[model samples]
Target: MLNEHAKLLALFKQTGEIIGRKKLQKMVYIAKKMNLPFNEKYQLHMFGPYSEELSLRVEEVCQLQFVSEVKEKKGGYQQYRYELSEKGEDFLSMMSFHFPDATGMLEDMNHKSSKFLELVSTVLYFEELPKKEVAEKVFKLKAKQNYSEADLDEAYAYINRLHQVAPKKGAYS
Candidate 1:
């Protein structure tokens, strides 16, 4: 029943801790974009791609004591930090599941800033659109972000690097 949840747990197991709700969302979205085993549905929100299902799943894991959520006040807003709990480690140890080898991918993303990941995920979201069109859409939709052409170029490069390293179409036991 916790097959998907276990995958999320394994993500935490690999990356020490994720420090923002948006970061967590973007990381998973980017993984899904790379054709990883994530099954969440996402829509473009104010922060780029957002997923309510993933949010609820994270909440469920927190409620089950398999993960921990810590709320911190960040000036006018709040930020959340997530990590796998001891119980979570125990649960994962007992579950038998296999996912692609995404360790390097996850580590690379885990070290990135949410703003960068936001741009990367946004670019991936509009990937089907022409390059210029994607640029226009990003500038229009995320005007407040102040992303420049150079940033877009960097995001594309990052996406390409990720693609080069993405796991082949197969499951890992």
Candidate 2:
């Protein structure tokens, strides 16, 4: 069994790096993306660390917009999903400042950019919203215009700065 911290890290990544409880429950336990496999995929429900507990922690810590429920199929049940609002991204970046690992920390910063965009893509895919509609929704939720486009550039710049500061391998030869 995966530990709670490992489960959190994996689930956060699996939910397109931003997702809701129902999907998280379904995917986390058996996500092939995370290299976990199980028989009877749909039947594998309730990936432990429980729904209510995870939801509270996610809401308190994750700096993402809490979107409405998602219906998997037409006339099917609705499950909640989250899209990272701009403020949410800001919130995540702020939290990253405290990451304790020094070695390869630059890689983590670089990963954050891709993760943010991936989260946006997840929102578009699950919500069935067109590109423009999703963009508009993100703008409204984050209370900022041009966030998706502009923030990518900002994230890249930070990543580059970190790379410059990281010690170069084999440079002393």
lDDT per model, in order? 0.92, 0.38
Q: Which one wins on TM-score?
A: 1
Write the residue-wise lDDT of candidate 2 on 1-173 in tens digits. Answer: 22332334433433343334544443332232222321112321122222355555455444334222333433465445444445544444444322223334323432343334333323323245655665565555544324665663453454345446643543311
Off by over 4 Å in 1: 170-173
- Candidate 2 Cα misplacement greater than 4 A, ranges: 1-20, 26-49, 59-74, 97-173
RMSD to true structure for each model, in Å: 1.5, 15.4
Cα lDDT of model 1 by residue, 36-81, tens digit? 8888899999999999999999999999999999999999999999
Q: How close is candidate 2 to the true structure, as a TM-score?
A: 0.30
Backbone Cα, N, C clashes tallied per candidate: 0, 2
- Clash pairs (backbone) in predicted model 2: 63-88, 70-79
TM for every model, in the order presented, reads 0.95, 0.30
